[model samples]
Target: MTAETHGDRQLAVRLGELLGPRHPVAAAAVVTPEGTHVASRGTDADADADFDFEIGSVSKAVTGLLYADALTRGEITTDTRLGELLPLGDAPVARVTLRALSTHRSGLPRLPKSAQPWRRTITLWRNGTNPYGETLAQLLLQTRDVPLGTPRSRYSNLGYELLGHALARAATTTYSELVQQRIATPLELDCFYVPVTADELRPTALHGRSRRGRPRQPWTGEGLGPAGGIRASITSMARFTAAILDGSAPGTAALDPVAPVGGGARIGAAWITVQVKGRPITWHNGGTGGFRSWLGLDRNTGTGAVLLSATAASVDRQGFALLAEHSLSTGNSDSNSNSNSNSNSNSNSNRR
Candidate 1:
C-alpha cells in the first residue's frame, strides 16, 4: 500500500484500538484549515465519509445556528419570548426568552412528562409520540415550579422543542424546512436532516440503547426535536465542526446572538465545553434509540473531527478525549476570540 493509504489505515486502526473495537458503528472525518479531509474507519469508501449519523443533541447546536441566522436576518432577536412566538396555553413560557432556551437557563424540564417511553419497544425511525405541536400543547397545560430567569441549569429537552417551534414561527416555515434553509443548505451539508421515516436514515446510522443495555427502537422525543433528532454523516459533521472552529464552513451564519450559557465553560447553544488535560475541548454527544454519535473541535487549533457510529458503545469519552488531546497539541494557538465573545455575553447575567 502507498504510504498515505497505509498511514490512514494505521490512524483508523489505532483509533479503533485505543477506543476499542466494541464501537460497532464508527465514522470519522478530520479536516484542516487548508480544506484537506482525512477519512478514517467506518466511513463508506465510496463517499467522502459524508455519510450521516443520528446526531442527537448536536441537533440543538444546529438549532442554535439557525436561530443565529434568523437574528442576523432580523427574523427574531435573543430576547424574543417563547409565548409570543408560539401559542402556549396557560404556561408562562411567553416570559421565556430565546436566550434562556438556548442557554439551558429557561427552567424547563429535561423531558416533558407526556413523552412516551416506548423507545425501547419500537424502532427508532417509527417511534410514535405527539409531534412538536402536540408537545407544545401539553406544555401549555403544565405548570412550571420555578420562575423565569432561574440561575439553575437542568438541561431541558422540552425547552429546545419550544425554541425550534418558535424559530419556525419566526421564519414562517416548518421546523425541518427552517433547519434546511438556514443551516444545512447554506453549509452545503448534503447528508443531514431530520428524517420523518426510518428508511430515510442511512444504513450506517448508529443505534441507541436503554439503561438495561439493550438496543432501543426509534422513539419520538415529543417536543424535544430542537434538543436532538438530527442525523448526519461524519463528512457533513466535519464541515459543521470546521465552520464552528473557523466560521469557514459552507455557511456564514453566526454561532450565537443568544449568548453563552451558564457561568460554567461547558455549553454553547447545544455544544459542550470539556477541558482535556489543560486545553478547552468544545464538543457535544448524542444518543438515541438505535443511534449514538459525538463531535469535537479544538478551538485553539482550528481543527476538528466527527465520529459517527451505529452502536451503543461507550467509547465516546475515550475517542473524543484522545482526538482532542492530539488535535490541540497539533494546532495550539493563543487566540481567545471565541472565549472573549462568550465572556462579554455573560457579563450582564450574574448567575452561575
Candidate 2:
C-alpha cells in the first residue's frame, strides 16, 4: 500500500477513537507539509466534506481576521470607538475600543441581557429555536441599554457581534457582505458563509442535534453573524486552515498573541493561543444549540487540524491531539507531546 494511503487510514482510526461511537456525525481534517487529510464518522448519507455545520463562535475567529485586515486597510484603528461607526448615541459601550472588544476586554457581558433570559433558555431547551435571531437594528436597540463594566479579559459574544458590525459599517457594507468580499472570496472557500436567517441556509446544511440526540433548529440570524452564525463545510474549513498556516488568509495577523487572557494563555483578536506540549498552538472552539467545532493551528510546524461535529459535544482536545500528532508525524516536533487538557475544559465555556 502507498505510504500516504496507509497514513490516512491510521489517521482515520485515530479520529474515530477520539469521537467515540455516540457522535451522530462528524468530519475531521489534518493539514501537514505533505498535504491535507480528511475523515468522517457517521451513517447519514449526507455526511461528507460538503455538508455544512454551524461553526458557532469560531465565527469570531473569522471576525478576528476581518478586524486585522481592516486595520491593514486603514479602514479603522485600534483606538476606534463603536460610536464612531455604529449609531449608539451615548451608550457606554460606544466608548469601548476596537482593540478592547477584539481581545474580550471590553467588559461587555457574555450576551445581551434579555428581559427573560430564563424564558429564552427554556424555549431553546424545549424547541431548539434560535434565541439570537435579532436583526442589526434590533441588536443596536438592545445595545443602547447595555451597561459596560470595568474593562477586563472576559469572553463576550456581544463584544464580537458589535465589533464585526462596526467594522462592516466602516467598510460601508453589511457584516455578511464584508466577509464574502474579504475572506471567503479571496480564499475560495465557496461553502463558507453566514446566513442571516434559518430560511437562508442551503439545502446541504446538516441538521444538528442536542447532546442527548434531540434534533435542533439551525442557529442563524443577522445579529449573530459575526459571533456564531457562520456555517461551513469540511472542505471549506480545510482550505481556510491551509490558508491560515501559509499566511495566505486575510488578517493572518490576528493569530499573533497580543494580551494575556489568564491561565497562561494569550488572546489575539478572537483567537486564543496556549502552550500545549511545549508548542504554542493557536486555536478557537465553537458550540451552539446543536453543533460544536474546533480549529487549531501549529504555525511553528506549519500544521493544523479542524473538527466539526453535528452534535453539541466538545471537540477541542481532539483537535489539539490531532495537530500534535500531525506535527510529530511530519518530524516537526519532539515525541514527548501530550494533548492540552486545559483546552477541553476552558475553550467551550462560552457556548453560543
Highest lDDT scorer: 2
After TM-score superposition, the amount by which residue 48's alpha carbon in candidate 2 deviates from its true location, in angstroms, is 7.2
Total clashes, candidate 2? 0
User: How far in Å is the alpha carbon of 40 misplaced in model 1?
Assistant: 5.2
Per-prediction CA RMSD (Å): 7.1, 3.4
Q: What's the lDDT for all of these models?
A: 0.58, 0.84
| Per-residue alpha-carbon lDDT of candidate 1 for residues 1-352, written as tens digits (9 for 90 to 100) | 2111212554566556544545544666665565635444544444433445666666776777776667777888878887678776445666888877877788766554444434412433344222332444555454243244454665776677778878888988867777777667877878777754556566655454433345654434334456666777666777677767777542224332233444445555655665555666666566554455666667667667666655544435554655554575466643332221121111100000
**True lDDT of residue 197, candidate 1:** 51
Query: Candidate 2 — which residues are off by over 4 angstroms?
Result: 1-9, 43-49, 332-338, 344-350
